[model samples]
Target: MSNLNKLDFSALEVFGRNYLKWVQDVKLHLIVKNLHPAIEDKMDNLVGEAKKANAMIFIRRHIHDALQTEYLANEDPRALWVALVDRFDHQKDIFLLEARHDWQYLCFQDVKSVNEYNSKVC
Candidate 1:
């Protein structure tokens, strides 16, 4: 059986435009690799140094080069995960604000199709 995991999405960008989705994707990847315990709450057990290194490698591989450089000193996957969350989690609020503003100005006639308009509303 093939052991390689398929990358179903792009790497986490520097600007964090896809931060939420990237987080979700990373969580799924970690779970699949049986490395999620390294980043979960109460990291008392279920994580050894080798497991942490492997999880860190997986995370570093899926992040942008700039992000990799920015977090170069984070040897622990749990620390790296928390650092990323602190930095990019605010983007969610910003995105929600923008979407809400756009929604207020949305017009039915301005959209070409319901699906297109619905996509925006979503």
Candidate 2:
């Protein structure tokens, strides 16, 4: 895995574009690897920050072929907003619609494919 700072932004942009396509296509079990530790740490920080802001966080992990893998994937905006409105929803740290849009914007500026975006962001 390359250092997070060494990630290729151009590849990330392409990845984001393709990711949306994959989501629309409902391709499950997307595989992304070779992530920098720093990136993972940042994700942890982001989740903590969101929690502090009264947001819920949902972490999903996959264990297949004796391997454990994790990544931040798409979120349901409407559900997130409803949770926010309740102010008691447990799934608050997951990015809401607005946050997701912002993230997508940033990702689109960096990655080139869904796989590449997942790798760079993760």
- Candidate 1 off by > 4 Å: 1-8, 107-122
Clashing pairs in 1: none
Q: After superposition, how far is residue 64 of candidate 1 from its true place, in Å?
A: 1.1
For candidate 2, what is the TM-score?
Answer: 0.19
Per-residue lDDT tens digits of candidate 2, residues 1-122?
Answer: 55633412222122233333223222122213211121222434333333322211211121111111212222432233232234423223443666888987987778777888788778
Clashes of each: 0, 21
Worst 10 residues of 1 by lDDT: 1-10
Whole-model lDDT per candidate: 0.88, 0.32
Each candidate structure's TM-score, on Cα atoms with residue i matched to residue i, is 0.74, 0.19
Model 1 scores a TM of 0.74
Q: Give the lowest summed-lDDT range of ten residues in model 2.
A: 59-68
lDDT of 1 by residue, 1-122 (tens): 45465455678999888889999999998899899999998846768888898999889888899999999999989899999999999988898999988875676668898898899879
User: Candidate 2 clash total?
Assistant: 21
**Candidate 2 Cα errors over 4 Å, as ranges:** 1-96
